[model samples]
Target: MTTQYAKPLPRVHDLNRAFFLGALDGRLVLQHCDACGHVWFPSAQSCPKCLSQEITWKPVSGRGRVWSWVVMHQRYIPAFADDLPYAVAFVELEEGPFMMTSIVGAEPEDLVCDMPVEVAFDQVTDEVALPKFRPVTGEAS
Candidate 1:
């Protein structure tokens, strides 16, 4: 039985294919050290702490708050021309990790520190779909 899902993202940065596939499955995957409990994003080969090679993948809640942000008046890529005036933000996940992505579903004037945000996925191309953040319902602040 197949459920509708995101297509696979293109290979980049020599990272593990499983990591990308996990995101396509609508679950956030990150590496955690079995020895020291250290977690790594972008899926490293092993844990950065304690030099442990015993790392495993785990799903995390995609909830976070807006830690910082910037309003981009110009598109660095032509593909993003239509998305001009977007807010690029760094969200510090409640799980204790920081992710850099665009903030959606809210106006620039409404974005502020510690604003409640939730993850939303967007298929930017046939190969890659990104996880972005949007303001949580009724939490406009």
Candidate 2:
């Protein structure tokens, strides 16, 4: 098997450590506000809705729909040069948060807005697993 090198790894700090750690065990987590029951991504110190500092890391169903997508024909970063013509997408999670991720397991031309998709984890390194999306098959959207 050929080993692939990951382009970049997220810096784990106290604020967003839970997110990266959750990926270690194949779980997709988001920041949830205990005060207003609001959940969001790209973790923050307080709830965006209620401005509550009581945030919790909660697991979410790894299912969503493709909100939008773009095909990268040119390599903007040297590390991504080998993987040209890939699709990067915004997936609207079932819990109401949109996550930026790469859509895999299907051709770029096959991706459509509002397509049902589910999360798939790719272990780029021993310490990190990136959550990606793939089209749902045999299931009604």
Candidate 3:
């Protein structure tokens, strides 16, 4: 179901469709290599470590920590002009893969390294849900 989504949309393909689909369902899915027992993001045709085509798209904990981030004061894209000074962060998931997204629950200035975060989806389109992160509060940091 397409809507009046203003921003750019991902090119849905065989390699990455599972990821987009899982996000739509409010779940985090990654590629699990049966041969090497490794999990990864940005899905691929085969395992990067073992080069085995035995891969499966499985759910993950959707929890991570902010490894690094940058607050963008410049408007690089016109659609993102309203989002200027937004925080773009790199999160290291508990499963080991790193995902680049924005943390929603905290202000950019308050962000710190190794901040606890969990996945939150922003449904920009009817078929695509952008995976984002948010601070996990009420827990020991």
On lDDT, the leading prediction is 3
Winning candidate number (TM-score)? 3
User: How would you encode candidate 1's per-residue C-alpha lDDT over 19-122 as one tens digit per residue?
Assistant: 55666677777788899988766577777768888888888888889999998888676766776788889998877788888888888878999998988877
The weakest ten consecutive residues by lDDT in model 2 span: 1-10
Q: Please identify which of the two predictions, 1 or 2, would achieve the higher TM-score against the true structure.
A: 2
TM-score of 3: 0.96
* lDDT (10s digit) by residue, model 2, range 15-121: 98788789878999999999999999889999999999998899999999999988999988888888888998999999999999999888999988889999889
Candidate 2, TM-score vs. the true structure? 0.93
Residue pairs with backbone atoms closer than 3 Å in model 3 (clashes): none
Clash number by candidate, in order: 0, 0, 0
Point out where model 1 deviates above 4 Å. Answer: 1-10, 139-141
TM-score for each predicted model, relative to the true structure = 0.82, 0.93, 0.96
What lDDT does model 2 reach? 0.89
RMSD of 1: 4.3
